[model samples]
Target chain A: MFKELIGKRSAPSKNVIERGAVKKFAEAINDPAPIYIDEKAGKASRYGRNIAPPTFPITLEYGAIEELVLPTKGLIHGEQKFHYKRPLFVGEEVYGVTEIKNYYERTGSFGKMGFLVIERQGTDAQGELIFTEEQIIIINEAARKGMPV
Target chain B: MTAMTEIKVGESLEQMQMPPVTRLDLIKYAGASGDFNPIHTIDEEATNAGLPGIIAHGMWTMGNLAKLFTPYVEDGFIEDYAIRFRNMVFIDDVLTLQAVLYKEEENKREFKVAVVNQKGQEVVNGTVVFRMYEVGMAG
Candidate 1:
């Protein structure tokens, strides 16, 4: 079976993190580096200021939710993509937009199945363009169980 | 952690975390994503590839971001979305995720959205267009 739902998400406000905070986050992920923690070290690298890791914004996704809602029984990642305009700095405010894209059904093992795709866009404080991301979550029994990994 | 706020179009999500890169994190991510592609799961393979160390499962990082957007409201469910990997997510790097709305209509039921990373990188650029409940529609 296939099900489709469209969502309207408002744009989030800007956020900023200091140099040390970036380092601590990197440390949480077990990263070992000076640029993430050291200012001069960051200046030496392509990033002029302490740069947040690529996945930094993910840390706050759940914080915006007031309830738990998603197809869980047979949801699996179908795809993902990323694009960028500039590197994030230590103290730049950030923002984003997430939209429920589309879904479809096809033949499968258990029966007919469906899948969903979502998109999110992020920006920085100066109103400079940042990056865009698209992701998929499968809600199909066949795709979740029968499909090859 | 800074005060997390509600998401809406025209606004922006800020201060997402982006940690550094490391080896242990790669292995952990390897276990999480179940894609032990030696380059991401093994130091030997990564180093040989001239990479500083083991990379991470791009999805794992993405998944973590997904978690932040949890409790997918009705509008966050399905329609269609796609993303393309831009750069490698090395282990130990704490990445962040952000999305913005492009289109929305409460009366008819529709919205379009996009996402990006802290480095202003478009980790997975795609769109989401889902239907929604009307102003007085009950659950």
Candidate 2:
């Protein structure tokens, strides 16, 4: 069912790497690193400014591809990977887009499951590539059956 | 502080013992990450979805793994990270984070990292590649 959606890309979404959001994310994860929260410490650090956590991109909005839809519950985050050219600085603006890389199904202990692979990229205002995130989401039989018709 | 020179392949980084997972943690993470996935924060929703109860977001657990490297910010930053979710983490589960240096290069280091539940079963495992700053290099 998801085969037709392979290679589909979403419209670019704009995201501002806000300081407040960064701080909340950092705290939510229980990481109190000065570079992420303290402005003075950020200035003293090598980056010379507050930077978002490596996984902070999860908080950014990646516009949805109209044809791609999955259940809101029971989907499993099977795997994830991140590659970064540089950390995103607070107050910087970046554009993000997601593409459906592939999709397949397999029978496992949990019964038949669908694996959906998607990749998201973030670019700075100058159009420089900042980071890429690839993830595989597992749709168990129950979740697959619950998908909207 | 661990200097770049002192890091040795085959050595273990200091392990971090995180407090038990809590519902409040998931709630805060949902608000911060904008994931708002009901399975992660609502017990009834999770049960209906076939889960035992509410569970932590995999991203929430993955995000905390970065804490193991915060001490080395001056030496370098994580250039790459990859992981698989081996198991679901439930509220009240105590997680211990550990990493071992597996490869070392002139300007980079690689570590195999894992987060194990209190039972010592790995719930997540992966690798992190840290890119180092050159001697006297400015940020």
Task: Report backbone clashes per prediction.
Answer: 89, 0
Query: Model 1 reproduces what portion of true contacts?
Result: 0.13
Per-residue lDDT of model 1, residues B31-114, tens digit only: 433455677777787686567876566555544443323223222322333344556665544466555555555522222333
Model 2, B1-139: lDDT tens digits are 5665487999888888998999999999999999997989998888877789998999999999988888888778889999999999999999999989999876789999999999989999999999887733333
User: Tens digits of per-residue lDDT for model 2 on A51-121?
Assistant: 98988999898899998878876678999999989878999999999999999999978789899999999
Reference-based TM-score of each model:
0.46, 0.95
Clashing pairs in 2: none
**Please, what are the lDDT tens digits per residue for candidate 1 over residues A100-149?**
66667667775765666666667766666676666666566533454422
TM-score of chain B of each: 0.64, 0.94
How much of the true contact map at the interface does candidate 2 reproduce, as a fraction?
Answer: 0.76
What is the lDDT of every predicted structure here? 0.51, 0.90
The 10-residue segment with the lowest total lDDT in model 1 chain B: B68-77
Model 1 has an lDDT value of 0.51
Q: What share of the true interface contacts does each candidate keep?
A: 0.13, 0.76
DockQ metric for all predictions:
0.07, 0.67
